[model samples]
Target: MRKIIIGVMGPGERAREDHVRNAFELGRLIAQEGWVTLTGGRNAGVMEAASLGAKEAGGLTLGILPTRDRNLISVAVDIPIITDMGSARNNINALTSDLIIACGLGTGTASEVALALKANTPVILLTENEEGKRFFKALKPKLVFIAKEPSEAIQMAKEILSP
Candidate 1:
């Protein structure tokens, strides 16, 4: 059987502690389910946390980097694909995954969610705020799943992705 790839999308450089923690928990849960984890490959923010969590859980991690500069890649990434596509790398990240979990809201993360929707991949937004609630309601109905916590997001992904 082919392994499922769960994409973890969020802020790249700086993020709140809660966001980072949620991403970590989400990644850990994804790994425990025997799924692979994919991220933007940066060494900061939610990307780093998720990748590290997956690595620590003995799960494989794929880092689709936005630059050809290998120095910026995360050490937790078991596989690295350097694209040099800048924000356009979000498209690759979205298309390559079977599902996506958005840990935080940002321009880049929103773009990734849009790209994932365009690619017909399931997306679960892991945030509980007015912005998140409004964004979820604004999107196409039944297209994006919203979860209040990391475990709920993972559960929703599993149910949505299940054949």
Candidate 2:
């Protein structure tokens, strides 16, 4: 089986309590589904939470970092792919992913979303509010699925990966 590369996009700071828990659950589910996780290599927020979850589940976690600094890499990341492309590397990361999960996000996350859309990779957004609804709606017919919880997001990703 071609390994399904799951991209997780979110901020670099510590996320809200709910988001942090959800991100961890999402990573666990992704590992359970036999998918590899790809994310930015940072120590806080959804990236760190998901990486840790995947690690605990015995899954491979790949970090696509913007610099060569080993100290900047997250502890949960098992493989670090260093690139000097800075923000431009976001597109490369998106291309490497077969599916993307967007948690609570920032500008960098937004860039990944755009790149995923451009690459025609399926994306699942985890958000419950009107803003998320509006954002998904605005991207009409792009195969961008939205879920209120981690399970739903993983389910959507699995469905997308089905042959």
RMSD of each: 1.2, 1.5
Off by over 4 Å in 2: none
Q: Write the per-residue lDDT of candidate 1 for residues 1-163, one digit (tens) a residue.
A: 9999999999977777899999888778889999999999989899999999998889999999999988888888999998898998899999999998988778899899888888888788876556765766477557788888988888888788878
TM-scores for all predictions = 0.95, 0.92
Using lDDT, give the best candidate's number.
1
Q: lDDT tens digits, residues 73-111, model 2?
A: 899999888996788889987899998898865678778
Q: Global CA lDDT of candidate 1, please?
A: 0.87
How far out, in Å, is residue 9 in model 2? 0.9
The regions of model 1 sitting more than 4 angstroms off are none
